[model samples]
Target: MRVLVVGGEATIGRHVSAELRRRGHVVVTAGRSSGDVRVDVRHRDSVADMYREIGGVDAVVAPAAHGTTDRLQTLSRDELLQNMQGKLLGQVDLVLLGQHHAAAGASFTLTSGIFADEPWPGVTGGAMINAALHAFVRSAALELPRGMRVNVVSPTMVGDSVDSFSSTFPGMRPVPMDALVTGYLSVIEGERTGEVVRAYG
Candidate 1:
């Protein structure tokens, strides 16, 4: 399968891209500063341009998004909006615009995180965005055209980032990057849609 992986420079994204390659799938990585193609999901024009450049693909995987980690009290309205624009709508718009550019049976695998269910202090913005993405996938799956499929992968803190987030996620067991990548693989390869494939350890 020919795959386009957005945010493919990140740790999880890299793992997903490599694993797909190992399985004999052709993978194209796209991101703002890295990857084979440049795309800033926060901008609709950039996303549209990306799809135009790539034409058609079997799958589009987004393994990264941005959200604020500041305390609720310190977060301004603009910050919250930025978080929503960058993580929630940014990813949703990708699917909305890429649908026409995707192949007949193309699939979209979006990324959320364990925060949707397992909330932590200073991450309310991320939690809300993750929850919203889950909801979007559930509803969008029912209305997608041409047999297109959409799913979200909600993973716990990955082992690769545990050192940095360990204090924030104290006592939480981090899932290995490999294990989390499997959640994405399942959505890319499986027929099930509107599902939240959880990779919580």
Candidate 2:
């Protein structure tokens, strides 16, 4: 499979991309500042341009999502919009625009996190968008054409990055990187659509 992984250089993205490549898949990585191609999902034009540059692929995996983490009350209007554009609308547009560029039977694997269900403080915007993605996948899968499939991977905080996020997700058990990647593999290789492939408890 020719897989295009956006944000393939990030902590989690690298692991997912590497595992896919190790499995004998053709992985083409893209990101804001890194990867084989440059794409900032926050903008629709960038995503559209990215599809044109790549032409076609069997799969598009996004392990990247950008958003603000401030408290809902303290988060300014600009910050709220930034969060929506980055995490919510960005991936939403990625799938919406990518549908036209996808090959027959192509698949899209989007990234959401555990916050959707278990919201910690200061994750209002991210949590809302993550939950919205679940509904988006459930509905979009029914309408996408040419046998295209879409699923969102909702992963837990990775053990590798536990130190960085332990404060935000206090007392929670961080999932191992190996186990988290299975969420992507399930949707990428299995016959599942409109599903939220949870990567941890």
Structural similarity to truth (TM-score) of each candidate: 0.97, 0.96
Q: What lDDT does candidate 2 reach at residue 102?
A: 83
lDDT of 2 by residue, 26-49 (tens): 999898898999998889999999
Off by over 4 Å in 2: none
Clashes of each: 0, 0
Q: Residue-wise lDDT of candidate 1 within 1-201, one digit each (tens)?
A: 999999888888889999999999999999999989999888889999999998899999999775658788887788888888878998998889978999988999988888999868888888988999999999999988899999999988899998898997788999988888888898899898999999998
The alpha-carbon deviation from the true structure for residue 161 of candidate 1, after best TM-score superposition, in angstroms, is 0.8
RMSD of model 1 against the true structure: 1.0
Best by TM-score: 1
C-alpha lDDT of residue 31 in model 1: 92
Q: Which candidate is the best by lDDT?
A: 1
